[model samples]
Target: MKGFIIYFLLSSITGNPLMAFLGVIIIYSLIDRFYLGFLPDFTRIFRRNRQMKNSLKELQVNPQNASATFSIGILYFEKKKYEEALKYLEHPKLKDNETANFYYYMGMTLMKLKRSDEGKDYIMKALEVNPRIGYGLPYIALIDHEMEKYAPDRHIINDLEEKIEKFANTENLYKLGRLYKKLGNKEKAKNLFSKAMVEYSYCPKGIRRIHRKWAILSRVYKIV
Candidate 1:
């Protein structure tokens, strides 16, 4: 309603409906980027690419540095260029330094590329390195992949519950709450959403800032 009013006023003043609509979109997008956190950041791709270039420069100075190569891979992954991400992540130098994150990222990228068997292996390796790695994201990804294959509802619920019980955080709690909502478990969803807010409050300031959007969404979902 507010957006329509703004659009109408802009069109009435400018006498150009298309230009006014575009203006409204730009204005709304800018506001959302800075304050609302509801819209995707369209400029993120350019910024990530710039970081990737800097990482490439680092490689020029030290050809054997896996850190630069890994950084470039992570940047590509952030931009959803999974194939390119896989290329750099799979670089021979990176193998010698395979941490839990390395395995998880490689596995997740492979899953995105439709290589599930190989992906699962790497994800399992990530778990072997650290079960609590990535705040339970590796386990959640496995569950998510299972869901894609029509895993039973009980199976998914068990998996999500186990992960949450092991380590509840804003990301997984809100995500599970959304899944519960989708499954028509309104009471369970609301409880999880409310718990997400409670858990968020206890997080360190830096982590809370990172997950602020999830906390806000949890509040909205709990109320609705």
Candidate 2:
């Protein structure tokens, strides 16, 4: 529809009826097949590169805008271009919460790239810059859990629990409950899950996952 409108406008400006109709059909067909349809891999790559180039141009115009850099970094990260994200996010102009978030996401990207030690270091730096951020803690715990699955360290779990108790936000509650479940503390997990269900009833992801976990646990305990 949008493509048709654009083609119509262009053809009207050029004052050519046959050209107008053909232009609309051609433009619409290309868009319907490539942009709206299952485009080829090369087309997807080309689009992504074009988007990155545009984002880079925007960043150049506003070099000190941490949000712009972060936005571009996020785009790169989504494309699995970790090196590019790292380069943009680690620019010295980034500071404050944006910088901290950049480090946290960089850690996640590094972890995805399978550089766990480097990821941990960046995540630790994120936490150090702002302990109250509440984002890096879960990543740290996740790394720890990955390293020693059976005997996961309790310190991260304990600290997270305390933070959840104090904050009681949806994210904190969900994380704490999952961490409890991972640590083989079923009773604690159940309680935390119940709390999460109440606190995050309106949140689709939290509600669904928490309720599913609660139902499973209830069945296991013969409570329902």
Q: For model 2, how does the per-residue alpha-carbon lDDT over 1-224 read when each residue is reduced to its tens digit? A: 77678777977887987788888777766764543332335666788788777877887897777777777877788788888777876777664554567767777777667777777777777777766554435453554445354675667656645644655655555555566666576787677667755655564662454344433443333222
Candidate 1 positional error at 150, Å: 8.4
Work out the TM-score per prediction: 0.69, 0.47
Provide the overall lDDT of each model, using Cα atoms, as 2-decimal numbers.
0.83, 0.63
Tens digit per residue, CA lDDT, model 1, 111-161? 889898789799989889988777776776676566556545766648656
Extract clashing residue pairs from model 1. Answer: none
Model 1 bad stretches (over 4 Å): 11-19, 60-62, 145-160, 177-224
| Cα misplacement distance, residue 211 of candidate 1 (Å) | 5.3
Steric clash count of candidate 1: 0
lDDT of 1: 0.83
Clashes of 2: 0
